[model samples]
Target: MIGQDDSRLHTAVLVGPEGERRRARKARRQAAAKVETDARRHRKVQARAKWEAEQAERRNTSYLPPAGEAGPAALRTPGRFRLPKHQDTSATLAGQYPFLAEAGLGNQGVFVGQDLYSGGSFVYDPWVLYQRGLITAPNVVLAGIVGSGKSSLAKSLYTRSLPFGRRVYVPGDPKGEHTAVAEAVGGRAIILGHGLRNRLNPLDEGHRPSAVSDAEWAMQVASRRRDLIGALAETVLDRPLSPLEHTAIDLALRDAVRSAEVPILPMVVDRILSPNTADDEDGRLAEDGRLVGHALRRLVAGDLQGLFDGPSTVRFDPSLPMVSLDLSRVAENSTLISVLMTCSSAWMESALSDPAGGQRWVIYDEAWRLMQYPALLRRMDAQWRLARHFGIANMLIFHKLSDLDNVGDAGTAMRALASSLLANAETRIVYRQEPDQLGSTALALGLTGTEQKLLPGLGTGQGLWRIKDRSFVVQHQLHPAELAAFDTTGRMTSDSHEFRNLDVRSGIPNDRRDS
Candidate 1:
């Protein structure tokens, strides 16, 4: 009984300390739990207040309708935007979208007219284009049917260029269309024909450049005289001269120059017909030159005698703003016209070769007629090829591009030369064409279907300009004074002269326009 009681006391003492320690740990854990619950409650209250404020702000805020803002601020309509369906060419569509059209040749050149597509002022200057690297060839090929106002456009181009210090030279004006323009521009028109007093001595020493030495001038004159006489003979004979015939003509020319102070065609012809005893050592020189001599005699004593037999009554003044050889009076005689052109060409060659002669326009007005003669065509080809070297721009006006087809047989060198003219000219202006002419014209110029179609429907003064690969539809605008001066139908329309004083811009006097 005593042992049991001792064990019970020890157990009671240990149990009492353990119960107090366990109670203290439980109290500390309960205090931490209470602190965490208070912190969580505070966070929940702050979050609820923030959410309520955001909800209040949202309830008061305004918003746009699904249709968009009303009145002037509206950017969208309630209904779908629609229009009638349309279809047209890209060329026409470009007008609707301006960015689609060409930027156009800049406004730095001469004012030509309006660009139909871009609705802007169109300007063109071959020299300006060349300097800007837009074109390598300064030559221009202009083809248009009669009554297309092409003549007026041509006149305006060169005349307007006069103020820029450029000179004009019309080598052969078959219809004398440019005569009035030449005279009006303070230039001379040498009118030559059966009855005209103006004689063109082919042997005349032409305008000598300030840069040429006396020796060089003499040599140039001799070479030109020889070439002119030969070309004239060839044009008449309608064939090239033989080698022996050339030698005979050379001997006769040398003798004539020695015997005369200023040699003429008659002197050359006389010597060719009857060779000097010393020069004709073989005694067959007269026989050799018989055909050539007679061919040339046609100029001095034959049917074509009057114009080129004696000294020139008028001289070609290169310093003039313009000079034109008016072949209108001799238009009926094709041979005579060709001969006269040959002489004029010689004069032109001398002046054109001058390095000091500023940039000039060499206008071949009736290029078709001029191209018929082999000699003239060859000379033209040479000049055209050397256009850039001589600082001259040649303008070849044709009735149609197909006129080139008649230049020679299809595959001949003559035809090739003719083709090269158009090829070398990077600027081609095509005016109104007949319906039938479309194919050949398009083929010749490599025109697009749209461009070809545009040709037949073109109105007066309107043209399709092909500058290199780019294309332009232009309406050639003319000043009132220009229209009056460039009137080619004066004889056809009697009222034209009477209405000449009227302003063409309004088709009435400026005073009457407001009335």
Candidate 2:
């Protein structure tokens, strides 16, 4: 029996050893499979690297220097292209492309670039490089010693934007560039010529100008004008007016308008302009009164009434796609420009307040003039307040930074205001500028050395486009037709001139002429 038990134990031990050998064989097979998989992956990586090298070679072969650069291929190092640093980051990569950024091929927008020699180039990119919607509407301040293509740039942008279905409302001064674009884009161009008539009149419909009972509209207009009125009074009166004083004046004006038999603006003006019995050294007080009176009279009797009470007062239609307010004709009348800007602010406020989501853009060329009026300044403030809600993007064009110096506190307030606009913009396009203006523009736009270099040697239409957190600058080219359309002088075409005569009555008052 002992011998049999020993034999069974020996057999059990042998079987156990065999089982262990089988398990080790299975483990070895698994390890071999994993190694094979890794080898395959390595081979795939090598193939990809080889393909990439070939692509690089092809790209290098295709590289060409900027059109005018005189260089042989051997002498010139090919331009190195790398993905923008912002693209590597998680934040901007995920964020929407703002209009301030150079739009890409994926965004379905066109990036127009121009050089002094070739005129312009148009690139259609469907992708947006930066989310323009994120930026604040820029108030453009264009300044040049009269021949630097300031007006042309404005017209180019306006015309280019038309095909995209933007509504541009330009209160054109007599220069007529804005009017021409409006007509070109199938928009109604109302020249503020002699005896301009309103197609729709709230007054004749047995409705008072303010009788619509739009409390919101009244509040919006008043709110936007508040700071501006104070600023204006300070400038005109040569003394700071307290908030309480401003409120009191505002209330008095409202009460006069509400209680008056005739239009209350004229009455309010008279009251504000009435002589102050308190002091004799009140030259500023008298001037303030006159300016205020003049402004009010112009508001009451000018095309501004149409702006406030006509079809424009109705909310903008997102479906309409594009709208342009030609203020070029009204540029001469600083007060009128103020009124239109005020009306635009109020209108934009109303439009944005509507819950149906709509995106809009406001482009201002030579916007420095707009800043001269406290009302426009206040309107810009309102734009800042309602930026996100309205999805309104502003593209401001300016030739030099110093041009802003003419507004109010010279360049200081202008700089501050511009800074606010810059802070809000997600993308900034800087064209060629004088050396002195470079630092301020860079500082304001937050540009890098590459971007700064892009600015210095750029031709007329070529410039650097920078986006927040972006490392690379994009070269923009404008279309040839668009380049041809840019108006160096604010002149109207023959058709536009004939169209101006179509309206017999001038929209502007004869007494308070523009400029």
Candidate 3:
């Protein structure tokens, strides 16, 4: 009993202290819980008030629309809120216009016409562009369908440049269309044909460049003669010359050049056909050149005779404002056409090579026909590459850009040569093209879909001028006299030859001849 009583007393003492300690811990915990609840409630109330204030501020605020408030700034509309579209002049909108457009080839150069897009005057000069560093190459390629006024644009480009001290050289005018212009500009057209008495000797030492010494001139003359013979033979042969044939040609040409002061093609042909007996030790020289001789014989005795067989009847005067070789008479003969072009191009080469030969315009109308022959194409390519050095710009006018693909089979050297011509040119003028040609034209020129669509709709005298990366839709303008001179519709007139009389409203005559 005593032990149990003592244990109860110890237990009671320990239990009493433990109970107080537990109550104190519970009270501290309850206080902490209450403080935490109060802090959470305060935080929730503050957050709700802050959110309400933000909502009120947002609800009360008002701002301008995304389309903008006024003027050109009003171009944009906010949140699909619509604003009526207003039309304005491009000149006015250009202040901050939202679209891209041709800024006009600047205010310099020749005045071509008005830009149909920017509504500003469009000026273009290859030399001026090159001077401005707008183009590295001053060459131009103009393509348009027939009756699309491409010829007039070509004529205008050179004729208009006359005042700028730029002379024009039409090496071979197949249609004689430029003859009148040549004469009108105080230039001469060397007309050649079976009946007409104009002879162009390929051996004639053409315009002697100022830089060429007498000895150099002699060498140049020899080289030109050899090249002319080779080109003529190749054109006629429809293939490049063989090595043996080349050897025969070199010997024959040297002999001919040494034999005469002004060697004619007939001498070369005779020498080629029947080589010098001394060099014919093997008797196979004639056999080697038999084919080549006959091929070149065509230029002197075959279908290409009478044109380049004798000494040139007319001279190529670089001093003239323009010089054109009229080849309309023999237009029916393709071989003869190529031969004439070759001879005339060679004749122009001398003047072209002259450093003193001031800036000139070389126009190649109906470019498709001339590019057919490999020899002529090479000559043209050389000229194009040397255009800048010669102080001249070459303009190759085409019926269509697709004509380039027709040059040769794909991946062929001819095709590559043809494509390089287009590549070197930075300024490409595309006039009206048929729908069928739109895709190829676009691909060749990198035209946008909109531009490709615009091709078929372009009217006469209107063209898409792509000057580098910039573009312009130009409507070419001309004076009354220019219109009359550039008219190509005379042959397409009505069947009835009825004449319409013009009443002399002013001091004019019914027939233009009366003036």
Counting clashing residue pairs in each candidate, in order, gives 0, 72, 4
Q: After best superposition, candidate 3 residue 371: deviation in angstroms?
A: 1.0
Question: Worst lDDT window (10 residues) for model 1?
Answer: 505-514
- Tens digit of per-residue lDDT, candidate 3, span 457-492: 999999999888988999999888888787777665
Off by over 4 Å in 1: 1-87, 495-515
Q: Which one is best on TM-score?
A: 1
**Estimated TM-score for each candidate:** 0.79, 0.54, 0.78
Instruction: Return the clash pairs for model 3, or none.
Output: 66-78, 67-76, 67-77, 67-78
lDDT of 2 by residue, 256-307 (tens): 4455432334445555565333421444544444555554444445445543
- Please tell me which model should have the higher TM-score, number 1 or number 3: 1
**Model 1 lDDT tens row, 1-515:** 99999999989998999999999999999999999999999999999999999999999998899887889799667789999898997767776885766778998767989999878999999999999999999999999999997888889999999999999999899999999999999999989988778888999888888878889888888888888888999999998999998888899989999988789989999999999999999889999999999999989888999988999899999999999999998899999999988899898898898889989999998788888888999999999999999999999999898898888899988899999999989999999999999999999999998899899889999999999999999999988888888999888787766587588776786557778
Error of 1 at 303 (Å): 0.9
TM-score of 3: 0.78
Residue 18, model 1: lDDT of 93
Could you tell me how far off, in angstroms, the CA of residue 415 lies in candidate 3 after the best superposition?
Answer: 0.6
Deviation (Å) of 258 in candidate 1: 0.7
